[model samples]
Every structure is written in structure tokens, then in C-alpha cells.
Target: MTVSFGDAGVVDVLDDEDKSDEAKEEVDSRDEEKTEKGVLESELSGEPYIFDYDSFRVEWKVVSHWEGACNVSVSLTNKSDETIHNWNLSFLSEDEIINPYNARITSEGSDGNKWTFKNLEYNQDIRSGESIQFGFQINYGERIDIPFSYSIDSSEKKVSDSDYEISDQIISSWDGGAVGELHIVNNKDTAIEDWTVTVRTDAVFLTVWGGNIKKVSEDTYEFSCPDYCQNIAPGQTAVIGYQLSGHDTSIEILGLKEWGNKDNTISGNSISDNSVSNNTISENSVSNNSVSDNSVSENKPVTYIESDGHQHIFIDSDEYELLEEGIYLLDVYSDSMTGYINYENEDQNDSDNENYNEIKVESVKLEICDVFDETIWEGDILSDDGFETWSAKDTGFVLGANKLIFDVIFSDDTALKEELIIINREASNIKNTFIELTDEDDDNIYDYYEKYFGTDPDKKDTDGDGLEDGVELFLLDTDPTDDDTDDDGIKDGDEDEDGDGLNILKEYELGTSDLSDDCDLDELSDDYEVNVLGTDPTFADTDFDKITDKEEIDLGLDPLNPDSDGDGIIDGDETITREVSKDYNGEAIDKVSVNIGCKGSMENKLFISKASDKSGILHDTAGLIGDFYDIECDADFETADIVFSYDESMLGDTDESDLRLIWYNEETREFVLLEDSVVDTENNTVSYTTTHFSDWGVVDGKAYEEAFDTPNTPGMSGTDNPYMNNDKFKCCDIA
Candidate 1:
């Protein structure tokens, strides 16, 4: 309908219909439409409908009304409460049709509140005193979800009463590629379901092919519109086209759950797999569901920064799921929020972190307040023109988030709060999974597992010793993955036993001190590591029970001790055993002790001097004893010699008063007194000297061999061999 307004800016509410003066004669000629007579007391005595044009607000108080064939008419109640002034007539558009409209009606009131309608719905009779009251109404451009209530009286009306609303649009979503039709409700409240519908959405590439939304059961639904269905009579809402794709960035989530598969389609009849989703772990991220889904992920956008006028940015990691903790680099985005924030690093040594053992992150510099344990290691912060890092001395470091307030100088002295998350790795957990195990051709661990288990693990045999995979993995404190388990920049496999890597014999540091392997990294191969390196394999150093890497090279000293010196001499100058066993009550029992004799040495001299042993210098007080018999003669004496032989039966003396035998327990490194036993003879030397023995004396290298039966003893044996009876030379020939 084309709306045309008069000079008064008031448009005829009838839309395109027309009227004329000769229209009166035209109405009279139409006598087929009857009318009632007799001084028709037609009334219209009420205020006009008023509204604030500026704000579009209205106020009203009910006054009077009249009933029509197809609509209701009312007269507004004026404030005076005397007469029915303003009037209006309302009707539903439910009967709107594409066919022609025939409207003819008239309202004549004396209070200048007169409305003449031509071709509008006409009335049949109006007798005197049977006043017809009507009110005016203005239709705003926009449709509001307004509350409406009305009652009907006994009358023959064409319109039916029903609770319905007027809307120009409808929305819905579908699973399958199912297409639905539209349903239209007629003036009689009868639905006509038929015509097809198409729907679309502004979201990228998203579309629903159906239009009709039907209410089936109390909750369930069956949406189908065909020629037999109630649809598209007139004024029925229908969808044209709809689609939805989505933005790759800015999670335009479409799933019903807060987090789940976005693209999932379940068939109406399918019961085998209705839910299409998968959950992992017990963190409640994803859930196990029917198999039917689709999705895509990518990194989050990066925000750049202007730290010291240098444009740096945080790289996007939105797409990748962050599980474990580590450092990362974020790229820069030109337009980003971080461009104003400040960050920094405070490393004192300023060593080229390119060789950083821990994970790396973007370094920067900024001024911030901190509480430090000054007595401990204090990290020096090194800053350049562009960047710096927040350095953490050997102590603990914490990075608080926006909870910590900071005054940024670069972006003015603004007190800005932001999330600060810098994490430094603690070396206490660093361990060498590799160790020197037994190997044939040195395939690391192949020979070990091959010989016993018939299978080999990926092992790193740091030492060339002939052991298998776990020999070093469990014992040597080596890394299985790296050939040079220590990562001291030395190959564990190629490390020389005498070199810095293998030889704890000369190594100094053995603690998790800034210069030590914090975790006592290795626990394998404590043998050679102790002996060879002179390291305390059990304890890292004397007094310091924690082992270190340097001493791990030694096979003797304990690799895990920080104190090789028991007397508080931690520098290894005087390493003493320090082990105190604690009782169940946590009290210290005098930590038990065991003496292990010095075993292997490059020097072939296995035994030290008797004097040195008796001195009680060796640990656990284990040493040799002094005995002239052990020095000059064999135990089971049978050899004929110039020196006297011993026989308890032929004893010349029985007590200390007469003089007797003296012997020393070599193993105990102490002298033992003999009983009052008799001696056959007192012994000396074949050829005695004043101060010392000959260059080729028994002490030089030779020791008396085991005893045997005598063949001949010059003057004693009666054997016949003449050479065996020669004893006169040294005594007579010398004269």
C-alpha cells in the first residue's frame, strides 16, 4: 500500500484509498447497504489522542468504545471524566490478502472529532441514544513485543480470538542437510504449511537450509512443511537464505558446550553415534562422544611492544596448546596492546646466553622493585640500549603478575599493571642419564643388553667399562640420550679417565654450589668415580655429603659428596670420611665405620712399609705389623743356613729372662707378645753388617721360599752328595 500524506503531514490511515464530495451521492445510490434512522444521537465528546512527538511517548485513560462487525472501537476517557472525547478503532491484519480491499465507513461527531471513511467496513444500524464511540491510534514504524489483552462479547464476528504475535523474521539451526517449508497462520487461526524456506547468517560460510520451525511435542520436534502443511497463506514469516562459516581468529565458537567440536552433524535417526566429541586426561577439556566432528586451530595473534623505542612483539601461540612450562619467543605485531608494557632482564655475568642450558626467552630491560636476600648470591642486572633480562642469582626467584605495580618510564611515568610470567629453571633436577657401562664395540648399551636380556636399550656408556645399559644409567649418573652425559662440553664416551672429565683423582669442586651439578645429577658408576678421582663417591666432598660432577670422574671418592674433608676442609685438601647413621628417632648414632684397604694403583707396589702401617695413618686403623721372622726367614723353616733355625722343642730359652722370639702381625700392623715357649736357637744373619744389609738383601726383592725336607746340612746330614757338605770356606778360608 502506497501511503500519501496531505498538506497537514497527516496521512490517510487507509493507505491508497480515495474520497470525494460527490461520494455522498455515491453512498446514497448504494441503498443496498441499509442504515438506521431517527435523530441519531451520534456521540464523539472526548480529548484527541496525544503523544510527545520528540520522544515518541504516549499516555492514555480509557473512556468509551463501540463494537463493529470485523473490529473493536473505543472512545478515550478525558481527564475531566465528563464526556467521551478522543476515539479510536483497532483491527487485526490476520485477514490481509493480495485480493482487492473494499472499505467504506463513517463516524460523524459534533465535537469536531469526525472521521469519514469511504470503502471501509460499514455499519448497518445506529438508533438514537445508541451512541457509537471510537478512539484514534498511531502506528509506529517499528514493531515492539508489546503485551496485549482483549475480551470479546456475544456477537457474530468474522475474526477469531487467539494469542499470537507479529514478527518479520524467524531463526533456527539444523543438523542434517534437511530442508523445511514455511507455516502460515490465517485470520481463523488455521495454519497453512507449505512453501520452502532458506536461511543464512552473517558468520562466514555458515548456512541453515530450512526455514520452518515447528513445535512438535512438549520438548521434541518434527519439522516438515509440504503442500498439505500450514504455510504461506499471507503475512506468514519465511526464511530466504542463511549460511555460517566463521573467523579463523577470535574464537567464534558455535558449539553448545563452552569448549568442544565446532562442526558436528548428527542424523535424526542415528542412535549408534550421536555425540561427536573426544576428551583426554581428567582435566575436563574434551569428552568421549559419538564420532562425527570437524575443527581447526591456529596460533593466537601477537601483540608488539616498544621497549626503548625498539619494536618487539610476542609471537602468537594461540593455536598450540600449552601443557608444560618453558620459555618461548613471541613475534611482534604492529598494532598490539603490548606496545606499551615494559619488561627486563638483570643478568650480572652477562655471559652469552646463546649457550644457555635452560630454555630461552626474549630478553628485555626495565626498572622494577624487588626483595633480595643480599647475603646470598646477588645477580647483577646488565642492561643495554634496547633490552635486558631479569636476572636471578643462585637463589629463588618469583614473577608476580599484575598484582605487582610498576611505574613505567618509557611510556611516561605511568603506573601500569600487567601479567609478568618469567620462569627460571632450577638446575637441581639436571642429571646425566648416561653412564660408562660395559660395551663390546661401544654401541653404548648394545653389548650389555645383548649379553643378558637379549635386547638393548638406548643407553649412553660414558665410561668404557664392560657393563650393559643400566650399569651406567643407574650407577654412573650419566645421561642415556647424550654421548657426553655430563654436558660439561665433554663427550662422556670419549672422556679420558685421566683427563678432566673422567679423572676425579684431581678434580676440585664436588657440590651443587653455583659451580656444581645441583641434583648430584649422577648416581651410577660410583666405583671408578671414587677411587680414581680420589673423590668421595658417597659424599661429594669432605664434610659436604652431597656429591658433585667433577668428583664423579673419580672411582674412589664419593661423587655425591660436597665435603671430601671431614675436618671442615671442604677444598679436598684433607678429605675425611663423614657418615653418621641416624636412628629411628632421628638421633645420630656414631655413624658406623668400615676400613677398605688401598686396592689398585698404577704403581705395582701394593704394600707400603711396616712403619707406615703401624703409624695408624690408613683409615679404619688397618695396617701391617713388624716381625723379624717375616723379614729374615720363612714361616715353616726347613732351609739350612748360617742363621739359627727355630724349633720350640729345641728351645734354649723359655721366658723373657732367658730371651725368646718376637713377631708382628702384618695385617694388624701391631706387635704381639709370645708366650713362655722354648726356642731351639737364637738367629741372626749369614753375613751381618753394621748399619744396613747388602744391595741384594732379602728386603731388596727376595723373600724366603716355602720350607721343604733337608737334603744335607754340611756337618749335620749324612747324605752322600759332596757339594752338599761344603761349609768350611767362609770360616777357615777367611783366616
Candidate 2:
């Protein structure tokens, strides 16, 4: 059949069924068509029909209709393997179409309801196996109906087969080769018992899946679908895939054959002579490959900044200036490192606005070393939001021309490395930089020096004595400028003036006065404070626990922390062990007195729980000894040595294994067992090394009653007991 527009040339659409089956088979053997109308036709057809023109397919549907207005949608597909360019579409309709848009088409001059449309710039080209679509509203006189038929211009002739068609499409491409699929459609009405398709290309097939290989060659291969697809039904398609190697981007479908029809060849071309008109097949454009390099190398972009003055930040840029070689000092605390990137486009106007690529900081590596590569500081710089920070104060720097190398990695797989010479010149200034006088007195010396001695504001020493200042004034209570303010023949430093058995120099070191026997005045003499009690002499109450230090010592309480046990009880109010067996309940039982001695730097500050207060302590109730005692010691003692002295009389034939020490963890609220306890049976004592002291108690609850007996203390009723006062441990001692 021949269809023609008024000025356009005639278009020949052959109706293959009109020809004899033998003649149709001979015509289909010459060329294998690239189009697959079965897929597009099946998508459009509510019913099936014989396909006569396999080159192109079109369908239109009325989306909506009212009294005078109707909406319609159209679809046009290139069933041929060749790309369609500058294509035109025409269709005969009874209704007048209006407001046409979307997939570009020109319908300016219509011919009596015979609407003719031509492709616009954007929709002009349609690649093989692709489709284009457009829609328009039509003003109809009455009811709306589907279009009777549609046609596309076949100005450019493409090779096709009448019996069947085969289309090869490249699915993906890489550096070397590509992977693709070949689609075969059976155009004949009869079932195809078996079929074969030959593909010829510049690249050789490395592997093929989902198809059975009928023949194989260096640059050509023939494959057929598996058993399920051996007998292809009319209008059905069979798909096969293969991976090819080499740089060739062209794929050609040479020939196709079906069962029981020797002369019915889809394409008559032999494998050697079959080649499509040189179409470049690629997954994506070769120029738009997205692979990038991520290796780190020394020869990369870098930046350097000077550290002589107050500036402390170093950053990377395309046009960065290098600093002059010099020895300079830099404040490490003020140092900062930053990195950025510049993205430019030639099409963009040259204004202040800049295009910045989305770049991320992957990692940052830095190293500081002398010329000998002796690493002073080698580590990774902390990175956040594409910036890094590092300081010399944090690394405890050295004082030389240190070589600092910074290596940074960005998300784009690019790296930047910079090396600089940094010299720390003012290392000594760091100590005195934060120090100031803080002198309260008018004297040249600071107040701290005057407090320890009696210095005159006019002269270095009063009384013109040979000895300077405090030896006579504060240390000995004698006038320093005077030869001898004291009428005694001996100088103050030479006399035991305080009569505490310590001479003047020893008293000064001991912070005692020559005139006063007791400086703290807590009824403890200066000698006792320095030698026996080990309490501070300057303050009357060393721990500042309201009660005088002397009273705490007399009560056998720790004079330092008010809440020694950390059970919310002060040591002063905590029950004391006065002759272990002497019970407060007016009951004296057979019990052995055990004296536990502590020997460590923290011995004087350690909290010891007496057996009398153990059973009645509860964590939440007032006037109750908490389950765990708080053992707070001076931080100086990393570990403490404790020895428990008990004889056979105390144990009463109890095995040593029954006696063990356990520690309580306040955070975990559980008791942890201690190991490696040394027992010296001959010395009648057991010792344990305590790395830390919280609440420690001997295991085997029987040890408490077995060694000594006392009446059970009543539980706390939220009322204060005469013996256990919560007021003493309220943490209000200092205030």
C-alpha cells in the first residue's frame, strides 16, 4: 500500500501477508530488522493484530472526554535498530485537536482534520529501541473515540526482515570492551520450533550466559535460546546476553534462521559480510567516564605559612606563597589548619560568585621531625568539616628547626602534602609567661615570702643582725636588724626558743615559732604536730572539719576529711573501737582485741571502719552507717599497705582461708574480692597491698562475731543517734 501527503513524497508500507509464503521467506533472508514492534505493540494493543510495517509503531488513546472537549495521549516508537532523525507523524481524525505540547511537534497548518506533526529540535532524534510521546486536547462535536490509524515517515530506508527481526543493544561499557543483549522476535504466525542468530563484532566474546552456543568463531558467534524458548510462539521474543573484550564499540546482527525453513532466512548476509552502518555502542559516553585516582604520592600540591608573628593558621590554595626560611617562635595553642578547593567553569560569568565542587576531607596525616627523621610527633591530625587542628603544647615539643610535613586526602581522591621548617625559639618563656607577682605587701619580696618570715619594709632585716629577717623575727621571734632583740646570749637561730626540742632552723622548716610552744594551739605541741601526729602546723584544723584537729586526734578520728567513711558519716561521729571487747551495750563477752596497723603514705588519711558500726549502716537512712565506707586518701599514695594483726586467740581455730579482704565499688554497687593476701601466722598478722581503697572488709561474716561480740545496733528510724550524728558529716565543714 502507498500513502502520501499533499507535498510530501509517497511512503510504501508492504503488507507481507499478501505475498506468497515462499516469496516472503526469500525477501526476509536479505536483512535483519532492528525494530521490535511486538514489545511496543503488546504495550499498546488491548487486542492483537498482524504487523505489516515493522519499521515504526504508533498508538493513541483518549484519556478523557466531555460534551465538547476531549484529551488524548499518543505514543511513537522506533521499532528499527537504526536511530530515527527528523521523523514526522500524521494521523486522520474527525475531531479538531487543540493545545498540543510536551514531546515537540509542529501542527500549525492542518488539512481538514488530517493533523500532520513534525519533530521539533529536542524530540527530533530517537535512538534504536527507544520511544517518544506527546498529548493534546481536542474539541469534538460529539463523543470522543480512539484514533483509527497513525503513520510515521519512512524517508530513510533501513534493512529489515519480513519473517522475523533481531535487535542488538549495548547495556554497559568499560575501558576495554562492552556487554550487550540481542532480542529476536518471531514475526511469522506459525510457531518457531527452533532458531539461530549470528552476531559479528570487532571484539571477541569472553563469556556468554542464558543462551546455547550453536557456533563460535574469533569475531563471530551464533547462539539460540534454551529449551524453554526452543519453540517461539508467534509475536514472542527470545533474549540472549554476552560479554565482549577489546576496544571495538560496534555490534552487528548478521543472520537469523528458524526450524523447517531452509530458505526462510531472516537475514541472508553471511557472518563475514554482515556489519551495521558503523553505530558507536557505549554504556555512557567515553568522555564522561567517572573513574578517579586515589593513590598517595609525594609530588602533590602543597602550601606553606610563616610562624614568626601572631598568625597561626595554615591553609591550602592553588596560588599560595611560600614562606622565607627563618628560625621563629609560634604559639602552639593558636595554631589551626584549613583546606579548600576552587571549581571554575568557562561558561560562567567572571563575577564574585564562584562554583565550589562538593569536596570532603578523607584524612589528614602530619609528622614533626628533625633532619635525621627522628620523629618528635608523628600522628594523624583531628579532622572536622575539611579542617584540621594541632598544637605544639599538646605534643611537648622540642627546641630546633623541626620539619613538619602535612598530608591531606580529599573525597575526590586527590591529595595535598606540605613540608615546613618550624623552630621553637622561646621554650623557656612558657613557664614564666603565666606567672605574675600577686604581692600583697609593699615590700620588694612577695607576700608568700613575708608570711613565712618577719621582714621589715625599710631594710632586708631589722636590728642589723648578721642573720637575715625571719631567723629572728618570725622563726625565732627576735629582732633581725638589732644585734640581739632577746637579752639571751645565744642568737635566736642558735636557741631552742619554743622549748619544743627543735632549734630555730629546724623550727622554721617545721613552720613553728620560737616564742610559741604550740602554733596550731589544738593542745598538740609543735613537736607532737611535726613528729607524732603528722598534722599540719599552720592550721588548727588541717582537714577543716569544724572540730579542732586536736579533738579529732583525741577521738581517734581522721582530722583531714570530715566524711572519712563516705557512708555519710564523719570519722568523729563514727563509732570508735575503745578496747575492742568493751561493749556499749553493757555486755562484755569473750573476745580478742585486734589491732590493725597501716603503713603507707596514705596511712594517716585512710578511713578504717570499726566493727561496732558495720551491721547497722544503711545507704539511704540517716544516722545509719552506709553499707560501704568511703576510703579517701591523699592522691600521693598510688597504693597503700595494710596489715591486720590478729592472734590464734582471735581466730579460735578458724582457718586462715576464711579470713579474706573484699572491696566495694560505689559505681557498680558490688563487692570485688581481693587476691594474693599474705598471711604471716608467726607474726599473728595478715597483710594486703591496696592499689585503691574504697570500702574494704574481711570476708566470712563470722570473723566479726567470732573475734569479738557486741549487741546488735537497732536500724535507723530517720532519727539521729547519740553515737551516730549525721550533722557531723553534712559536707558543710568548709563553709
Candidate 3:
């Protein structure tokens, strides 16, 4: 029931099963790739910068000083270095882009209207290496509050980082000799399941965010020492702190002007920087409930570095790397302590002040323990046999033979680490798969091999082939023929993934088919169809057309009657219809054995007709005398050869009683008794006797040998319990 169309276009395979959403989500990525090829290619050139709604993290400030107007302070930078001075500064409010050009300030549309700020302006040229400030004289405008956040989506080339290939998500961190952390926060509403995250530079070394940061969705994840992250509730924030190693690439902020305040334009916003800074500070609070969508928001109250005076801190003697501005130590020398200056507070330049002494040298740690998965390799330790051990640690951390540690010293807070080292070393090798050896028990075959020497290659291979089953399955490819693939014991576990121990003698076999060379795998194998199940191997009727014996018996149809019309193909689908017509030469076949019917006599014995050419042929054999079989013949066939058994032993008949058996009655269209022609016992009464031609001819004193011209022709029927019928053997010459 299959059809194939080579020239047909793609058609839907309509099935009756209702698939769930997961199946639908498995989109054909191939179709998507084909259709999106052009769109992807177009974006490769030009590289126009685009930002989403949540591009920058913004904080807002609004202050009162110049009467009803507000004073504002802002910090802006172009993250993109390549796109240079092509950036424009547009001051936007909910109403207008308050500039002469009146450019649409944000990434949205504006209604055609005539309203904008004109009071505030800066005519000075701003370039790659300069940053300047301007004043705004505020007047009638008030209440038209500006959105809090501000950002510059710059066009920059990203660099790719060269790191090891990671199969699963892991949480770890690397510090470029800085005092800040590389934190990772999970933001999905639902606890992420089976998710992996990797954050590293795409290409160029992002001085701001460097090294590899990965996290797997485990119950607990660690990035640094004792450095696991906590769940941050909604509206919360997390930071990946790093020293902002001096980044000064001519970034310009064309202009800075306020577009909103209550009224429309900043007609008169001329205020001194000194005055605005003071006024803005007075109205600011650091502990405000956090919310999204707003602009510049304050974190800590406008705090300043203690005005005691700047200390000359020699961070990197060779490289002028600006240690990120979180906090700083006076010296990175080992053992330097930190303290506040009380007596030295009055002398801003007191060189003798002991309060200026603070030192911390950064180092990595290699801690090992099995207390939990987080504490396993949070730092630098190799994973081996489930035991967290060994390390090259990092280069910054000293490579001692025993233990490795991180160097962290803090004054304001306890370092966020239980283990820290201040030096560098090398990376450790993670040995994932191994082999072991055992001895034979000398008794069991499995024990001698699988148990005793399975793990240990030396005990099993006798010759040093360097291969083992467990190792091959876990690490090496399952193809056991080659000792090493590409000369390595570890294989790319794709092919032969099971390592099912396939050998030259007993190779792994197909999951479904029988072990027969000549068989159709799609249908039942020839062995199972014919030899094993005793079914017709040549049958195409899976549902078994009424011709096959099973189906005929089910329908109560006469199977032995091949042509129920006396034609061949016993009710077979192989009709005379051009597809499968078969002709069974006028001879009917009776596959007979013993006929034990529900009648008075077990007289149905194997009887060959004296008019065999008239009785056709029966394909029964020697051992079949003890069983019964459904004989098949064509409705067209009027002559059938049959052999039925009459048990003289069961009837207790001594001198075989004259017997005869009747099969299907052509006249009645149903079965009628035919006295068996043979009997060796005296207990049964039969007319068609087997002893002599005279005995058989005297059936019922009618002499059936001459009764109906003898069985000259064949007959179509199921059972072969033979005897003499009064029908005069119509098959001999029905006309």
C-alpha cells in the first residue's frame, strides 16, 4: 500500500496523530537558513548600530535651584571607536528633540510639531580627544520630565577570544590582577532548566569585560572562590566589577541640553556648574526603590573620595592599567595593612600618616573538596575520578607543588572568597576517562572477561593494543577494530556509540530482522514467514486475502476449494482481474491426513482413487496420516486426489467394513456424508471397501465403481473424508 512520485513537489504527510507544542517548536532550521540567507548577508557590511529598548542601564537626576527650573548633570561616552565624530547629540523629552536641528532624539518617531529647547547651546567643536561642559539657562519650562537613562550605541569592531572548547556550561572567573569580581546573574523569571550561558569577548579584548564567564543551571553555581550567586528578585541588579584600565579613545558627545522640565523649551537655562552640582546633590537620595524605564538614578548618595589628598599608587610599573575605581590599595606589596586616618585627616598631604598603608597582591587559588559541586573547581583544580585534585593553577599565582591560593586583602569588606591566591600558574588537565585491570576467576566466562579484565586493558589485551570496552564506550569511539583513532585513545563518540562488543565472530546485528541472508527486512523475513511461523512466504496479502488458509478459515470459506467457483486462487485477491490470475490445470489438490469428524465412524481413511487421473492429486505425505489438513482446489477443477485414514483400531472392526466417505455435495451446495471406501476393522460400517475392487464397487450394494462413472473429474471442497455419493461423480462429465 505504498506509492512513490519522483516528480511530485513537496506534499504534506497527513497523519492522524495530534502532536504537542514541542514537536511544532522543532522548526525546520533548513528552511529558515534558505530564506534568511540574503537578510543575514546584508547586515554583514555597513554595520549600522542599533539598540533595543533595554540597551543601556540608565540613572536619572532632577534638581531645583534656578527658581521653578531644574539643574541636571550627565556623563556620556561613545563605546564605539570606529564610528568617530559621525554621532549627533539630540536632547529629547516626551515632547521634543530640543536642538537646532531638532533631530529625533531617541530611536522612535515624533509627531510633526513646532516645539524644542533653544535656551541651552554649545557652539564649540567636540572631537575624538575632547570632552566639555555647557550651561542651560532655565525659565518657563517645568514638569516636562526627561526619561532617566541616556546611552550612545556606538559602532565598534568586536574581537573574538581564543579559549578551550566547552561542552557544558560552567561557572568560573579570571581576574586581570584587579580587585573586582566577574559576577553572573540569572534573569529568567522561571528557574532556568538545562540552560547554559557563556560570556566572553566576541573577538577583540574587551578591556571592560574580559576572560571567560560561564554558568550552568545547577542548583548552585560558582564563579569565584565561595563565589556562587544569589537569586536576585525582580527590579534588582548585579554587576561584573573590573578595573577600567585607562580607556581614552577620542569619544565625543556633540552636545548636552535639556528638552523637558514642565514647560517646553529651556528659553533661559544659564546656570553655573558649581551651583547645579550643589543643588542636584541636595535633592538626591541613594536608597530609592529601584525601577526600570527611568534615566540616571542614584546608587550611593553623591559621595566623593575622601578629600584628604591623592596618594601616588604605583599599580603596574610597566603597564599603566587603571585598577577599576571600586576601591584601591596604597601598595600591592604583601602584608601591607589598611586603616583610617584620624590624626592625619587635618594634614591632607601628611607623608607620615600610617593610615595610607594598604596592600593586596592578586593570586589565583586551587582548592579541592567534595563537600558540594560548587566547591569542586570554583578555582583551579583538575577533575579526576570524581576527586577534585591537581593544578597548574594560573600564571599570576605561584605554582607550588602542594597547594595554590588567591591573594586578596580588603579594608571595607571581607573578601568574597574563602580561597584566593596572588600569583599565576598554568591550566590543569581534566582526565575524564581511564582504564583499570583485574584477574580471571577461572570459572565463569563473563567473570574471566567482563568482571576480571574488562576495565583493565593490560590483563585483557595480552598484546598491548591499548583498548578496552568501558573506556571505549565512555571516551573512545565504539569502533573497537582500531586501537587508536588519529593515534589517540579518546575517540569522537559519534559512530558506534554503544561499544556493544561487536566482534568478527558475533557482530552486532540489526535490531529487528531475523538472522536470514535471504529475506525482505521491510516485510516479515523469509525465515520467520516460512520456516519458523509455517506461513506462506510468497503471500502479499498482509491482511490475508480469503485465499490464504488463515483468512478462509476465519470467513468460514472453503480454502481447499481454490476456485470457490472451481476456479484457482481459493477466494484469493488474485482474481482473473489483470493483476494476479493463476490457473491450476484441471487437477484439484487434497492435502489429506486423518479425518476425525463428529459422526458415528472414524472411517475417513487415506483412499487413493482407482480413477486418480479423475481424482487429481493430494500433496499429503507419510507422517500426515495422523493429522488433518485443509485441502485446496479450484471451482474449475472437478478431479481431486485425496488420502483419508479410516481407523480400524478405533472402530474395533476386524475384517475392514466396506467404507465410503462423502465430501461436498455439488447438488445440495453443502457437505454430505460419503462412506469411506476402506476399513480394516469390523466395528465400523462402510460400503466402499478397500480389500478389492469388487468390495469398493459394492458400496451400499450400489457398486459405486460403476455408480457414477467413477470419480472421472475433480471437485472443489475443504475436507477430504471420502466415500461414495449418489451424485454419480458429476466432475467426471458434468455435461
User: lDDT of all predictions, in order shown?
Assistant: 0.25, 0.46, 0.26
CA deviation > 4 Å runs, candidate 1: 1-479, 482-609, 612-660, 663-735
Writing each residue's lDDT as its tens digit, candidate 1 over 497-530 gives: 4333433212322321111222233443344444
For model 1, the local distance difference test gives 0.25
lDDT per residue as tens, model 2, 1-735: 211111111111234325575753443442224231111211222221111235655544444556677556555667788756556665555556776643434443244344566553334456566666566887755344333344555342222378788888789997446778788888888755446677776554544543555336545666754322445678887766666554464778887764331111112111112111211111211122221121011123222111122222353422223343212234343233333322222322245434334444556676665323345566676445434343222343333234565655554444444445444433432232222334443434433334322345445544454445644432333444345344467654566766887666677766677667788677778877778877887678777555567766655667777765688855544444222111122211111222223221222343445333344332332211113334455433344565555445545445655554455555654435444666566765455766666654444433332212222344423343322343322211110
Q: What TM-score goes with each of the models?
A: 0.14, 0.18, 0.18
In candidate 3, stretches whose alpha carbon ends up further than 4 angstroms from where it belongs are 1-52, 55-59, 73-299, 303-421, 424-735
Clashes of 3: 109
State each candidate's clash count: 146, 14, 109
1-735 in candidate 3: lDDT tens per residue? 111101111111213225454542332222333321111211121111111122221122333334444344332222322212222332333432222121222332252222222211121112232322222322323332333212232221211222112122213322211233343333434221111223332111112221212222211121221122112223333333322111111111111111122222221121111112211112122222332222223221121122222322212322112333212222222211111211222222355645435322122234422112112233433223222122232222111111112222223221212221122112121111011122353221222123222233334332234433433322222223234333344432222322322221221122211123323322444444444544443452333433444434344554345444555544554322111112222222122222211111111222323222233222121111122223332233222323333443432222343334433333443322344344424433232211111101112212323333344324523233143352332322111
* Per-residue lDDT value at 145 in model 1: 11
Q: Listing every candidate in turn, what is its Cα RMSD in Å to the true structure after a full C-alpha superposition?
A: 33.7, 35.9, 34.2
What 10-residue stretch in candidate 3 is worst by lDDT? 1-10
